[model samples]
Target: MSNYVIQADQQLLDALRAHYEGALSDRLPAGALFAVKRPDVVITAYRSGKVLFQGKAAEQEAAKWISGASASNETADHQPSALAAHQLGSLSAIGSDEVGTGDYFGPIVVAAAYVDRPHIAKIAALGVKDSKQLNDEAIKRIAPAIMETVPHAVTVLDNPQYNRWQRSGMPQTKMKALLHNRTLVKLVDAIAPAEPEAIIIDEFLKRDSYFRYLSDEDRIIRERVHCLPKAESVHVSVAAASIIARYVFLEEMEQLSRAVGLLLPKGAGAIVDEAAARIIRARGEEMLETCAKLHFANTKKALAIAKRRK
Candidate 1:
């Protein structure tokens, strides 16, 4: 079996725990070790934020944790031609995306953008692309321009609300559907010019499964919905939505850091545990309810550490 070592955080480890739960496992101070659902892969995570992957699918499996990619079913994408200023920007399309869903702290943010023929070329010219490919500083700089140019809406599910949702046993995909559908309707209404000819989604779940999750919602945009993986690679409207959603996520993170008087770091890991312990020691355990998603295993680890501090 091949062995590979790389970085891992608490949240990523938690994901691994969820993914490899049924397999034989061991949790220790050094890290967590488990056999993946596929017996072909065995992985170990370290408290130092490192992960070691061995077995056949090591690289592929490790990437999912590192990238925060959805573990849902994935299908091969028939790549669409790369969009140019004259081609894609010439259509009436609305695009949607979300940010901070994988984070241990902060709210889930969903954003949608409507771009008609007149403004598509403008956004394309601005070089707006996938938010994942761009850094937070880049997003901050580009987001204002999109806000001024596009008709859009952003919905935020802050920590308190997110905690409540989890407590009520809401599944992540269903929550995402609710947010995306809600944002799409609100943004479409905000456009006021015309109904978009099509709504494009940076597909997370399979198309049918995505819609199935929406059954719980009372109102959903009954528009022509087109779901594509990596839609932001060529769709300017989707890219615009991604930028703003990510920008807002960062801004909220900043606000959270300021409130807690510590750089509340992103991702779940050992450092996050330390930060949580700090928050608990300074503000008490209840304060974490406002700052973190209680569902995370990080909460338990941090709480345990907090008790030691007393």
Candidate 2:
């Protein structure tokens, strides 16, 4: 699919909005500019003059609004392998990515998926993009399809375990590398493909810093490791990993919410803090440890709120 991000004036944005007014559907809720959904494309327009166009006809659609076409298109490129993975002469690759590390209420989930050449078309047709752009329902729908066909492994660090790991003084980067490497290796071992071409990691750190995190660990597959940012846009495997990770994270959040009998919102925002405070008021601080990452600063605010209620 052809996609582009363009900076346009309000006039241009208004023009497009009016063009798609009736066909313009509400999708993602941004502050000012709404996501106007058309039959073939999804547009995220911001009042700040940033507009993103994504879908098969993204370029054509955006051309109707913008004067100059932005040449930056991620369609032809696959994640972690844009050039390096292709150099390997085959699309048989494993890509690793994670989700929910920044969330206040869910587990940190990492997933690795092996995308064989034969399944490339299949994966593309699944409309696998970065997990951030996808809604919970879309992710939940696509994840199982990827899981059923693609060889994959997912590792989840629940809140309690995440807190314990943090107390052990391991940085999140190191922990991510640990899980990503292990999951990729496990997926590779499970499939045991005939010399899979490349193994890519969604680069969380700089090229050197990422390796530095893995320097102490011998588990990393240094070979064919393409550490790329926003790899999900390019590599189906990374996108698949992102989706599956999100699905699992959402599932964990659902279970945690059920256990607490409250809706646990994502992110470390003020709203999340309010929810945390409510949880603590009902259950003791001990129960918060089970449902949330205790190391976050939100814990302190929730404790204060709990004390205030007392």
Q: Per-residue alpha-carbon lDDT of model 1 for 1-310, expressed as tens digits? A: 4454555567767777787778746444344444343577776665666666666555345434544322221223211222222333456889899988778878899999988878888987887998889987899899999999989999998889888888899988888888999999898788766888667888777556677788778887755675666777536899999999999999999999888888888888899898999899998888888878888899899989989888
By TM-score, the best candidate is: 2
TM-scores for all predictions? 0.70, 0.70
Residue-wise C-alpha lDDT for candidate 2, range 1-310, written one tens digit per residue:
5566677777777877787787666566656477777778888877777777788556445544545433244544322212422333246778889988888888889999888889977987999888899999999899999899988898988888888989999898888878887787788779864656777678786444676677777676666576766677556888888888999889999999999989999999999988999988888778888888888899999888778878
Query: Model 1: clashing residue pairs?
Result: 10-268, 10-269, 11-268
Q: Model 1 segments beyond 4 Å from truth?
A: 1-90
Position 257, candidate 2: lDDT: 97
lDDT of 2 at 140: 89
lDDT for position 11 in model 2: 77
The clash number for model 1 is 3
Least accurate 10 contiguous residues by lDDT in model 2: 78-87
